[model samples]
Target: MKLANVQQPIRLGAMTLPNRIIMGSMHVGLEKLPNGVERLADFYAERASGGAGLIVTGGAAVLPEGGMGEVYCNVFLDEHIEQLRIITEKVHQQKGKIALQLFHAGRYAYKEVTGLDPVAPSPLQAPINRTQPRELDEAGIERTIAAFASGAVRAQKAGFDAVEIMGSEGYLINQFLSPVTNQRQDEWGGDFGRRTRFGVEVAKRVREAVGRDFPVLFRMSGLDLIPDSTTIEETLQFARMLEEAGVDALNIGIGWHESKVPTISMMVPRGAYVWVAQQVKEAVHIPVIASNRINDIRHAEEILQAGRCDLVSLARPFLADPQIVAKSVQGRFDEVNTCIACNQACLDHIFDGKVASCLVNPMVGREVEWALAQATVRKKVAVVGAGPAGLEAARVLAERGHEVVLFEKQERIGGQLNYARQVPGKAEFNETLRYYQTQLVKLGVEVRLGTEASADELVREGFAEVVIATGVVPRRPEIAGQEMPHVVMYNEVFEHKVKVASKVVIVGAGGIACDLSHLLVHDEVISPEAAEYLLAYRILDAKALHKLQTGKRKVFMLRRGKHVGTGLGKTTRWATLAYLKQNGVEMLTEIEYKRIAEEGVYITRNGEEQVIPADTVIIAAGATPNDALYHALAGRIPVHLIGGAKEAGELDAKRAILEGAQVGRAI
Candidate 1:
């Protein structure tokens, strides 16, 4: 697990990167009015200062008709040059190289966002976005090529070291490359050569605009993973054409927006798509950047040592820990916060039309606001609980030269995280827990496990400040047969404190309910250690391993709301729903919980009452704040309530961690 190769330098065209790490482009709407110029500049500069060798910015629309959303940067106008120059200048100040990713959304672009009709190779609509796009004629085709060339010229004028053309992920170039989207009989469609002509022309035009000295990277799909999409053999030919057309490097991207295959989720094993980069590297002499599910430096190093690719590109990992490279270089790998691939804040926030943030690192998008300052007066602080909130508060306070003592009632540290990791496809939570444990030890914070601190004890101990992050307690809704022997809470089942029969009915449909249903029905249960070993060794694909765990029982998930799993993150909701459907798990929504009995549970749906057979009943309605200690010591001490102790309406680790950090810095 030596990472010697990852620390080595690499060359792409005329630019010699300081290392092999590249910050891949990911859309995070940071641009605002007035001071947006400075905000965007500071955003990339932070990552540059953290020791990234090279950075590729998010998509910059080359044409108004090709814009994905209103929040994306626009390279189509001349006024954008000065605004973009700020980012390039700041990145250069940190001795970091940057590339502008020129994008054309094609059919995926929204007309509502750009106030122009979307255009593609043909009039066909994309499967994922489902927006009908106007077909490009001869004149429109020429305009698109010219627009891309103009974008490259602008990037060069802004002092960017390189420009990467977006040809992957079912965009305009991908539309022409796929027969399913481009059903035209014209020269830009039909056979492989004709289908690839659009991408090759754009590359040649961009190269001509920026000249031979400037680095030109092209991102292509190694595997489209969609119906009627271009095959790897066809993509390889397209790669050759791109190389011949003056593409200095190739970045291997897998799947598409509409692809059914799971590429980036936690269920996908780490480095699952490294083989894609290996195939492309074999076909081209140019440097190849491997992407998708690469979270650790050791994994990146392994890929490089095996000659799978020349460089490793990571997006979410940098969001989780911007100093990942610096920490690894200093031999502090255990302190690095690893991305769990939850997509709760990053992807889901972007989809919700908000600035992207991170679950583990709350200071992701708001780097300026969350910047740590030295505490003027150090005080003795007590953090009650060892959940995400308490851990973060203790870490920040200890880093600020405060004497912090973290108390956990459980024998092991991680509060609800211990139960969360037991669910399928959630072993990554352990990495977050490990990071906090390592940081606490490194910062010399006193950790007291299996110890509960009461209000009287805290007052007697004479602590300067007390942070009540006591977490939450499950709500036991009042029902007729709720006290029956068959009734149990979701946490009871996960902790193995209660036993259940094969047939189970779960009340309420949130993240907890969904996970419990999956756990109950799934046939094979793999230990976290075994799963991690398989993932590290690449012994079995996670998807395949998951398929082996066939459903063994009939489970029903009932929700009183209109939608099921409404509390789930937007990015992962689809996959979870699909998994439940595929396993024959019945999801009943907009129902009234009448009562519970030993043989079954009674529910009213659409004004009709019915009894659903169930041998076991699990309640996952919601949780309430455990604020007894805080209420008891309201005026006695300087008490501060945070995390679930403040609000526990939903399972929100994002708010819990962010609030903890905020309180820590304020104190």
Candidate 2:
């Protein structure tokens, strides 16, 4: 697809962006001080130099009470201007414009972190981050408005080209806009105008603070997907009101923490929310920026060419490849590292109170540390296994001017990813593999397919360094009757190496077990080719695909732990569990496995023995490090263990890829 419109310049208020692409704000939690200055500047500067037209820093707390649970920038004080100035200067040096997203966490703010009870439009608590928020009185509402205005002035003084008000994501302004959270009968909550007054007032106050010449962007939810929240029509009316309130531009955001709709997950199709931005763009004269799940240049171009929005905002895509825009402009889109929207590293890290990183790009939050330098001494390196870890190690070493050879026992690359791509809703996993394949070919790394080099052979080959990333092997628990013909491993089912019956019992409730249950219970076959075909044509939607289960088989997932899917990422766990329940997949947690029988499986739950009838038994009981080769080569040659071979605790792509990059750079 031609990206003529996507590469065109756009004007937003008083600012003329070099291109139509904007780096959407995402919390990285990289601040080192309350005044919000330090390595965070380095992070933004890298993206700026990489060719983003405009960079929007993550939300900075507008008030002391609005402090997020994690470390975030604070723009409420005068001292913050100096530190913020450092960031603006760095971006300016690259001729890139920047904006600060001013936010108030509202009820989402943790009392433990802020040392203050959260305040909302009403006393209603948020569904996700449950907190008993105190109702904001009239004076408190006025104070919040003033705080937003003050934050804008601070941003202006810091030399930002524009400032964006965080009126989306169920924050303070959004709390007042949504009827579900705003139950008060006061001036701020009774009618539509009353409910939207908080956002309108903040926009007006910010415009007054920054003056008409300075740009002011307001981020608004085009559709509050949560129940009892604002509708699309209401959102359009709100957009018009915001424009009248002096908002220079509108950024359309979708869903919330409490919304049932999938916003940023891999299950959601690309450009799914472009229609939301289209409605808002038609409702108001101000330019609109569309965000969420726009991954590749083709998708971004589709949204722009369709006139859905004037500009496109990408968050995770920038994390995956900071040079995406530059690469696209230079007609090198194939070289771009496309974001798979796994949310494993970026969102999961933020929730864990750690700095956000990327699964594919290890240099995301650690740009300074992971920056590549020309190696003074190049050596011959051998990377065993072709998993994510091994591919990353080989790619980095080759980029550093080292002679590298990647060996895989299988005929093709992508060790575990090959199996993962067969599961339902996991077709996006192939993008990671595709990226590695492209990089290996581009770097001229010698690839040995179907060649399993033994320790002795590697030693004789005289490789200066060896990276053993053999990944993991399924763990077979010692249980009576496990050797029955009906028993099979999860991978065996995917590989078509085993026969199964209508009734199945899967041991373990981790990610693998859940995925297997989804695969077994669904009647429709979803091959990688079929999934890609459907996605390309937009023939199927996530909602329809989720409810397409015919329940041809009865599957039981048993877990010894108290909870199921503990290994699953927080963003996708709820939806997975809901899918299993809707499809009649029985989940039994806190069960002790007694034995596997040809006819069924026996287990003990709550100190009571029970027999679950099953025609076949599948083992999803985790995995173990395939470290025998590493041990065999240890000390014989310079052997380095990475990925699952180093430690088989959880199937974390983030840890695997990061470890690979670290080892490659160090070597």
Query: What local lDDT score does residue 628 receive in model 2, on the 0 to 100 scale?
Result: 96
Model 2: lDDT of residue 146: 96
Worst 10 residues of 1 by lDDT: 32-41
lDDT of 1 by residue, 1-667 (tens): 4568988988788888988989998887887434765777777888888788889999899998897555568899888888799999998998888999999989988877788889988888776565688999999999999999999999999989999999888788888899888888889999888989999999999999998989999999888888777988888888888989999999988887877777887768899999988999999889999999999887888888888899999989989998888887777789999999999989999878788889999888677877888789989999999988999999999999999999999887888888778877788999999999999999999999999999899999988999999899998887789999999998798889998787889998888898887777777666668877887898878886676567668899998888888778887888888988888889999999899998889999999999989999999999999999999889999989999899996667888899889899989
Q: Best lDDT goes to which candidate?
A: 1
Clashing pairs in 1: none
TM-score for every candidate vs. truth? Answer: 0.95, 0.95
lDDT of the candidates, in the order given: 0.88, 0.87
Candidate 2 pairs with clashing backbones: none
